[model samples]
Target: MPKPLFGMAVAFGLLLVILLTAMGSFALFDRLDPPPLDKLSDLSVEVIDRDGALLRAYTNKAGQWRLGIDLDQIDPEFIEILLTYEDKRFSSHGGIDARAILRASWQLLSNGRIISGASTISMQLARLLEPRQKRTFKAKFWQMLRALQLEARMSKREILTAYLTLAPYGGNLEGIRAASLAYFAKEPKELSLGEAALLVALPQSPEARRPDIAPRRALAARNKVLERMATAGIMPQSEVMRATSKPLAAVRHAMPQLAAHASDRLTRENPGALVLETNLDRALQEKMEAVLRDASSKLAADLSVALILADGKSGEILAEVGSPDYLSVARAGWIDMTRRQRSPGSALKPFIYGLAFEEGLIREQTRITDSPVDFGGYQPKNFDMGYQGDVTIRDALLMSLNVPAVALLDAVGPARLMERLKRANVSVTMPEGSDVGLAIGLGGLGITLRDLTQLYTGFVNGGYVKTLRDSPAEASALAQATSNMGAPILDRDAIWHITNILKDAAPPQGAAKMAIAYKTGTSYGYRDAWSVGFDGRYVIGVWVGKADNSAVPGITGRSAAAPILYDAFARSGLTLAPFAKPPLGVQEQDFADLPPTLKQFKLAGLWASPSPVPEEAPRISYPPDGARIELSRTALGRQMPLIVKLQNGRPPFRWLGNGRVFAANGRRRSISWTPDGQGQSTLTVIDAAGRADSVSVFLQMPPSAP
Candidate 1:
């Protein structure tokens, strides 16, 4: 009854089954052997600072700097304009739009020439992922097939991100990020509407629309994109009109060059890493480098400078200006002097005095002669060549007189000083086969600014020391810092004393020294000048001089480096933090409160061997060299018996600063005198044989009225 209709139904079912089977086979083959994106995977390294600010970017193996980007990383309007201009049905189509393809085919046939591209963004991505040199029929077919495969395997957002990342915009400039940075000097996320339109239009014919070479063509292309957007109602009419009138960039900008040395070092340290993040503050780094460059003009063209700023509490290096001008051949700016070892002249005095205070060899009120003194063959003099006759230990240190500093070094012993520095994690290099000597107190040993600054950190950090680092902390860095820190260089009492003294160090004219405790040093023949200072927050070390070690006349830490240091702190905008509270037992005392031996540092018995016979060499026995004698005070607060005694030396002896003077007679070994005041005073005993001994004893007289 229905033979023809039944035959048609059976053939229809068979045809449906055949089409389904063909589709399943094609999908399976496409999944198994998809298009490869091997070429696009070779990305260049991106070096960033602590704040994720770009420092430098390198090119890929193909010598093109095509940074990867995501659709979300760009403005939504940019995506809208791109889709409306390139492919209207991009989101709905599998890969290619059939209607657009048919229209393109009709146009080509009617005009006998290629009219429009029926390629979606995914199709463009396919071509970028597996580029073909020629626009042939076979190439187009493969691109369409690859686009379909990509659409099936990846999400729309992933496909769009890849397209924005890999799209070629002309010679060695690929992707929105690269092109935006090149033309706008900014990131894709920060591009304006006009900037986005220009980028979207350029990829269609990158060479033809290159703004640097053909501004008119780029403008026309961008205007056409805006017109299309307006016609499609993608963006508001006002925005379209505004964007169309905006100008295109006529020149390309170079990429960022912040932290050049740090970035170069990071690449060398962590090769093969696609991205590196450091601990440096890019803004601070750039600012400090600018400061250094500005200061470079004042220095001789042949001289350079180096600076490092680090958080004292954490030892994180915030900024490091390796040289005044890294590219200046005349200044040898390529050398990172912060790591370069140079003499640290008077900069070492604080540590030497610190060691002396630790050993109870001297006190802040101890009276030390600044007159010229020689230790064996080594002789050190003051910077001005004029001694301050008699100066307090604090005065000696604050003034940076070389003689008194050497005297303290002689007392502590040079080897012990070096041992303390090593325990505090400072690398030291002495002359080959030479033993540690007094000259170390005057920059005798070779050391780098890094080591010197680290030592000072220990001195100022309440005896705590740690390794300074430029990049983020690593296990190795922490281990090195751990090995270097924690064991106090001196007791809190000693460290506090050193800090209190250095805090009062005078600054150069028109500089703020109270904000930081700093010291300056000039190497031999003024070859190197250094000013290292620290506040409650950061420790900054600066070195200025010729890299070749050629002496520069009149260059010194006080004049050249200190001024720069203060200026740098001012420019850094870092608030001067307060110093840590002084530890308990760090009592402030005047001269009369110091021990007898501490009153005047003795040099006679420093290296004296045990005496064979009882020789009359003049020895004071009552109040010993370091003896603390407390005299009773009467109601007046300034009355007591201060007895002075001596043993050994010729009979007749004379005591200066005492009303009674002995004549040529058998020495009255013991004598008694009334306290003149409650402060410290130097007591001198001279034997008839011309030998003498001096002791500074603190007499506990009554406190004066406030």
Candidate 2:
């Protein structure tokens, strides 16, 4: 072989050996000392509104406000300025810039001190990941190596994101998002020139130049960034001058805390979620919160207010203020009143009237006695303790006449009313060990403000109740599906009648009339004051009370809560959506023009005069003897209530189930009772005239019983 060829072969062999050794060393280093990325995932949980506006932020386990953000979420100008100020060669460098390092070294040697930083964004991110307490040569060497590894593993954008996310901005705030929100009370998506410069300058010597602590130093640092921008021609001189002229924000604004209770609940339900997106409107939530705060301040001490505003059609909760001030210890503001069940006073009257309408027992124009009357042993009086002698059903409901409502509930059956409300997905809870009675129509039962608002949505949405939801994802799913709507609370015609009557109710003083159909309710002893109203599109429910369940004397629902409801509607900045057209089979008529059966509402064996002589003996008309009846059962196999009717029964009948008295001395011929167990049972009824009837029936469980 030729001598020159041999020499070239030797050189090539040496070069290949060196390259192989370098590759082996790189692989070994990566396996032995990988980057710590677990902390990067420990970002602060954020709750945002429907349009992606921050409602609240929670610190991470480390007690740092390090919100996760991407490039798209940040302003492009801020990115350009940051890149220009931090690393001009960031885009072209592999991880470390050779030119910058050489320049920095030359400056240090020439001045005997550090002049400029040679660390790229990647190196800064490495230092953040494995933070060092002090600057040392070993730390710098490891950071440079980590930077190289990061460049090999992550894209430029990812490195930039990690760096910015972990960049400290004094105190507990770590990241541009926290700094922007804390300093400017806004997001970093659209930052001003001065704001951008301040943010860029914060990461370096963050504690020394904190804007909230040292305004003068912060201002100097921010001006330096602006000057650099001008020198680098990244920003025009005029803009740089304007930016420098702006004063630094010396005080940090509190982070957004809108919908605090709702956010808290969502975060608890969805633990480990980085971002929770709800259906709330930030502007409306802020406005309603302010209104409640202002209104609560004027009320008695320790009295708190809660409000909820939702879209009637979609059931999306736009605003939910659980309390006037979530931080007020005097008000016990941490309690979420919206979810606390309390007596709803007469706010439930419309449903009773609606049930009566549904049963063909009465119409809006039907005359009903509102004077004091006894329903069995349960008697209810009007809130004002004064009653109209005789009034139309519309007028009775408008006035919220308790006697009239209880009478209607007696005819409708308290169990049946509760059943209808349950079908509408409105939760109603009776006091422990209390039987269903007429007094429930007059605020004897308990319901939450949220459920009450949901119940009223049925009236506005043509009788169908919309299940209230706050999460945007859930709302979107609901919009695409109809299975969750469940059954209507009332027939369309009945709901229309109810809506027509309620819309005419007098508004609180200083409030506009005819804007909405509203009802006010004051629980017993003024422990709870409630006003729930609905326009064509929105439903707002307000609750005012002491968190400890103490009474506020002289505080009535119409006086306390109705005004807030009206103010909420006015400040909602929404055009009044027109009510739905009257459903089919609905008619407007005067009292004298109605049918005879529909003109007067009379309770069986109570309101109507009894016959002088018995027409026939009492006989079990339903569940005929020796018949098999299919009854509905709950998931736990408990039998649901059954309605039994008799052909003819005297007043105050006694009903027995399997020799056990279930209902004693009931006046109505039709009665509802729940069977204790599923098999053969004998139901007997004894009338006032000593006439008795008995029937044996077999109850079969429903298909869904478990």
Residue-wise lDDT of candidate 1 within 253-323, one digit each (tens)?
98777776777777889977878887778777877887787666655567788888877766677888778
Please list all clashing residue pairs in model 1, or write none if there are none.
591-680, 592-679, 592-680, 592-698, 596-625, 597-625, 597-626, 651-667
Residue 385's lDDT within candidate 2 is 40
| Off by more than 4 A, model 1 | 1-36, 70-72, 110-115, 473-485, 512-514, 585-587, 592-597, 604-706
The per-residue C-alpha lDDT of model 2 at residue 386 equals 36
For residue 133, what is the lDDT in candidate 1? 97
Q: Give the C-alpha miss distance for residue 70 in model 2, angstroms.
A: 1.3
Top-scoring candidate (lDDT): 2
Q: Pick the candidate with the highest TM-score.
A: 2
Task: Compose the digit string of candidate 2's lDDT tens values, residues 1-706.
Answer: 7755555555456445533554456667877889899879999999999998999989999999999998898999999989999988999997877667766665665567999988889889989999998899768777877888889899999999988899999999999999998998878887999999999999989999998899999999999999999999888999889878888879998888789999999998898899999999999999999888767755655778999999988889999999988888878989999999999988888889889888988888889876556565565756544345778888788877777787888888999988887787667888899988887888888999999998888877788888888886565554334414567889898888888888888877556675799999999987998999987889999998899988865567776788888888888898888888887768878888898888887655655322344456688776689988766422112333565767665556788999988853275555556788678999998878899999999986644211
RMSD of each: 16.2, 16.9
